[model samples]
Target: MALFYKSNNAGVPIGWIAIMLALLASMGGFIFGYDTGQISDILLMEDFKLRFATCETPGVVASCDFTVVREGLIVALLSIGTLAGALIGAPTADYLGRKYAMIVECMVFIVGVIIQMTARHVWQQFAVGRLVSGLGVGALSAAVPMYQAETAPSQIRGSLTATYQLFITFDCISIGARDIPGAGSWQTVVGIGIVWPVIMIVGMMFMPESPRWLAKHDRIEEAAAAIAATRGIRKDEAMSHPVVSKEIEQIRNHVQYESKMKGGWLDCFSLKDKILYRTLLGMSLQSLQQLTGANYFFYYGASIFQSVGIEDSFITQIILGAVNFFCTFGGIYVMERFGRRRPLIIGGIWQACWLFVFAAAGTAVDPEQNDSIGKLMIVAACMFILGYAMTWAPGIWILIGETFPTRTRAKQGALSTASNWTWNFLLAFFTPFIVSAIQFRYGFVFAACNLLGAVVVYFFLYESSDLTLETVDQMYCDPECKPWNSRHWAPAGYESRHNLVEQTKAAEAHKPIVGGEESRREDVEKSGDEGRTERC
Candidate 1:
């Protein structure tokens, strides 16, 4: 909280424009989180279970007779649409700027919500509705963070991006809505989730386009204006603002370099230039982020509570949601302070330990009779959520958002998000069966998965702290750079050259010119082009 209010050493507070971008973009995250959280509670509803009934076992209650696979399908349908949307959204985001892509996502979400709210007859309609809604969810997931990353300053980038997860934790409030009585309550939950997306669409109309995206397409004037607006400076004043000028120069340099490369989706897979290797690492990192098995807790936490003989599982969910929501603050703080890799390794270890405790407790005590063990299981689950919310949940997005170069960013974002959703689909699809078949022992599976994730983090993950996005790009572009070797590596003179660009701008700001403003503009543009060539 103090960090949000504090200014930089030069006494410049973060501009409201950058803050607004983060806030509006994060609404997409809230909507995504709401859908994720709501479904778990909906799944526990008797009405929702009966509406999607596929089995008819004699003497079984209608809800009780719902088959495991069918229930899993109902819960997992959203991820299927998410997988498709994330794959296609990259090309769409590149074609349409990030802001408009988000607007398009909102419109799709509205259509999906209408379909869901109006469903009268069958389970298929409900599933179709979830799939449609998921397409929008997937698109927003890919676009929003990319937009936020491009807009934020490097100093607070981790915390600002982590706000996406903070807004996600806001969905915990939706858990309380589950107690709404009557058969139509689930419909109400679905309808209510639309509020944040609507706000996001309207609010985005007033935000600036990403400066980096503008520069990528050679819209230099617009890019400068966007940077000016983001910095709360006049267009003329922007040329002398050291941080803004340096960033604009770096973006221009990167874009110029990209223009010389073969820019296409398939270019991302070129092994000759090591693009393929970098892409694979990003995709695998995302997969490991999901395969950490966090969503299993999100999707089936209610059932886990029930297995431990807690009668009012909704209340338990509320408690869990609160724990998740509050603990996320710890995550936001450590992300910038600890960098990205170490905290993840530490969190994975914590998650594995708590899950093992939960599993062992379940095995040792009969949940139906042992109140103390039931409480212990709940505590362990909350502890697991704490570890995850503070680490992988926020850290993965920050790392992924900053990983790829501008040329391959959208495609890599699409690929990375697609990998995440694919694993999400599989886990959501199979979790019920895993829990039912293994009972308490299912905890061992995720515990082992967390251990694997920790091992991966230790061996393969690299630290990406206090560096500009351009420098990070250059690091990856180097032929000698590998994932494990990144910690010790430094690209030559990029920082000093960046400072020189800023110093030159500040010096020129004080000079008198015969050609006036237009002449200076031409000189700046020419200098930018030459700098691009020299840097390349």
Candidate 2:
């Protein structure tokens, strides 16, 4: 555990271009956060309920009845749709390339948003719209991190990929809608959703496809250009830049090795190299991330506080959103400066403590009888949120993004993401009933889950903080490596602990660049023979 601090070295800088691409791809996450966040407020809106909520007094906003089942469906259907979309998004990313897959998902989101916006009165129609829109969000969620992890430099990959979750927590615009009731057509609020996806659709045109995706599909020249773009090196100089050459070599070796091996759900679980254990590990972590209970606040924050006798629940949700938004930056900073394992383990325990306290303070005393108890509930909620935002929220994305091998990255990442949405759907659908039955007592269940998550991390999750993506694959490939003792582990033949930094020092990877422009290949090949590239 002490070695954790020693492994937090920054490896190599790729360039600003990769960061820009990651941010642009993260627009999907922004859209996901905003659209999902607005629903909590919209569900509380009397006008919104009058229009779409099934109610006893349909025409009268004051006397309207909001049934829990209908309310849950409006939120849950999006998760269901997202689950389906995530499944489809993976193969689409494999077939169409990450850039175009991004465009496709954005378009899908737009169509769903239009459906939700234009719904005249039926809640079912709106739910259908959510399902449609979820397809896009689910797909983009799968695609964005894959794109970021594949493109990013290793030392910063966790931070960059975790930005997806950062954008997911950016509920600023939507959370503010509660106070702006008279601003415009509330129907058009869903229409506002299209703006994010539209921006991404255009942005993808200028961005590079994931170099790994291009290489996997055998588009070698384009892959070289993409690697060049990410590194901010000239296309002709790409094969000569040691970092670029080594990355291409790694990608090529992985794809080639995967070609000779059988892959699928069956093979993935064959236990030949503990692939099944790893697969389950990734997906289970994603599922556990959702089960950590932060969504309880985001999805139903307004109602949760209102139940505690807070008149202005929107203010509290906004407070929570602000806390979530800011803590994500700390999460990014800590993951890069401290590595992944310690923060996640510590965060889980921190969250468990607050969750237990929150549950006790909320349900242990009658908040209705004691004003101080209600206030304490809010404090506990914020602290619990603070832990979630800084740890499991961002950590899972970075872990899964870098965890799976390139061979199974798209499909396996899809399964991982879909696992998240599956739990999301269950929570969205069942939370109302659970709350009605136990109210704040629900926190205890999540508290237990968080405590379990820490144990799981300690026993299973290896530190992937600064390892190159392929080097991570190499870590899992080597049977000698142990998760708990991997703090100083480097791949075979590497002097430096960080594989990416070793590449920068002109270490040889498996092979030279091939099938790019002949001149570029010749330069790279000649340099490979000379034991280093001259482009640097």
Candidate 3:
């Protein structure tokens, strides 16, 4: 019920510290966005062509244009690495702790940057470097947010974490607009992408560990200390609050119960129907975000502009990047105030409309006609970015983190994140083929996907804003929460074992009839020292 930990004083300056740390840590996402957007410009470069030139046969004069195949291969290789990393990152995060996982990812990222920056051969060595960097990005996408959310106070959590998405949008815009004014100078753009990971390594060096992770490990005193240090509170003062202490105890208990309930992969499949549905929904949303072809705009906008006969195509890529950066701010500003559902609904409809307009422009407009159609297509692309920036891009991650119960949160989050990467791999890998088959008219396919996604959101997704974690679980499990079944959403058929109301009542009922309160207090004092504490 309390908004913040008791140890947090009325005027404590910890909020700013948390925000700064989160911003720095979230640079990983910026690196991801930069690399993704940089591809558009990279492909347009003559150097890109020279580096990847292929021979017709061994020692024969090179016949295949290296530029075209090389660009596609680099992008595809990165996506493949990301797919592999996403699957690996989840279990690593759960086992090694989020901070350590990030440290590992940062090292991998730096190595990739070095290889890419210095590489001469584009075949085997270039692919290795791209894959390494992609691995870092894939893991970082999952680890950074999890770390930030666990460290943040619940009150300002959404805003602080949303910064990750904000930075990514900005990075995309920056990469698109960045130019070194040479024909084969895309290396400058690639170098710019390295800055984010460097910032992440330095920022994370000073941040405190996640209190929730400590608590889950049954290290109560260490968790308390982390909570205090991160929030700038005294340890005793933090532990003195009944609500804070209770939540800590609950986390510890939940983790212990999970250890006892551990089973094989089959057990994960044996979960209740509601659990399965929620997991699938989270995965579906993540996949849908990619399938909508948003990345095509981010990764290939410059090429698209060139196809439309735009002058200074790289400059247009930069402008599109700027649009992406600015519009995503709209999503961040309104996320908490407007809540999740409204933005998603509105954004979805907006995206569908913009996609249709874009498709129509591509279908109807001639490249030689007055330059008007090209401008119109540009506007439509900006609108699509606006819609995604505001809704599906960041909102899907938020929903995934908050949807599952604590017992299943890590595993479900991992599975959902992996699903996203797998679909992302497909999109990035096959985009070239799609564009080749459909020509520059791939906008129509994306428009259709957006329409389908909007329909899915309308029927399946529910309002989640303003609800506590327990309330969300109940909403999904209770038949009354099923659409068209209840006048008002509530837990209907399922027993509320983990419901806050029931948990509180049960806790109260177990209060000793005679001197039980005193014993409970003593137990709390004794168990406080039995918890884990580790410093990186």
Best by lDDT: 2
Superior by lDDT: candidate 2 or candidate 3: 2
| Model 1 misplaced regions, further than 4 Å | 1-13, 46-65, 173-184, 307-309, 479-490, 494-536
lDDT of 2: 0.77
Better by TM-score, candidate 3 or 2: 2
Candidate 3 segments exceeding 4 Å error:
1-14, 46-48, 54-64, 172-188, 229-232, 263-268, 307-309, 467-471, 483-536
- Could you tell me which 10 consecutive residues in candidate 2 have the lowest summed lDDT? 1-10
**Local distance difference test values of all predictions, in order:** 0.75, 0.77, 0.64
lDDT of each residue in 1-536, candidate 3, tens digit only? 11232211222124355767678877877887777766655655555545555646543334435555565677778777777776677777777777788888878877887788777755567677889998888888777777776776544556667778877776443334344454226667777777778778878877767766776677787776665555555657767644346546545654564466553334445456366776777777778878777888876666557655766755776676677777777766667666666677677778878888887777776644636777777778888887888787777766765676555666666667778778777776677788778755787777777777777766777655434343455466555465333224433221232232332323322322223455434433332232211000
CA lDDT, candidate 1, residue 295: 74
Residue pairs in clash, model 2: none
Q: What would the per-residue lDDT of candidate 1 be over residues 1-536, giving only the tens digit for each residue? A: 01122322123325678788888999988988888877767766665655556536533336254566666666788899888888778888889998899999988877888888787647778778889989998988888778888877666778888888888777655455566775577888889888988899899999988888999888877787777776566667666665467568778877887788875889889874456766787788788778776776666676567755665766666777788889889999999777787898899899999989988988887765777888788789889999999998888888778877788888888888899899998887777667778888888887988888888877766566655576666665665655566666554422343332332333333333333455444443343444223332
Per-residue error for 67 in candidate 2, Å, reads 1.8
- Model 2 residue 304 lDDT score: 50
Whole-structure CA lDDT of model 3: 0.64
How does each model score on TM-score? Answer: 0.86, 0.89, 0.80
Q: In order, how many clashes per candidate?
A: 0, 0, 8
Query: What ordering of candidates by TM-score runs from best to worst?
Result: 2, 1, 3
lDDT of 2 by residue, 39-123 (tens): 7667767678777766676677777756877877787888898899998998898889888999999999989988887777788
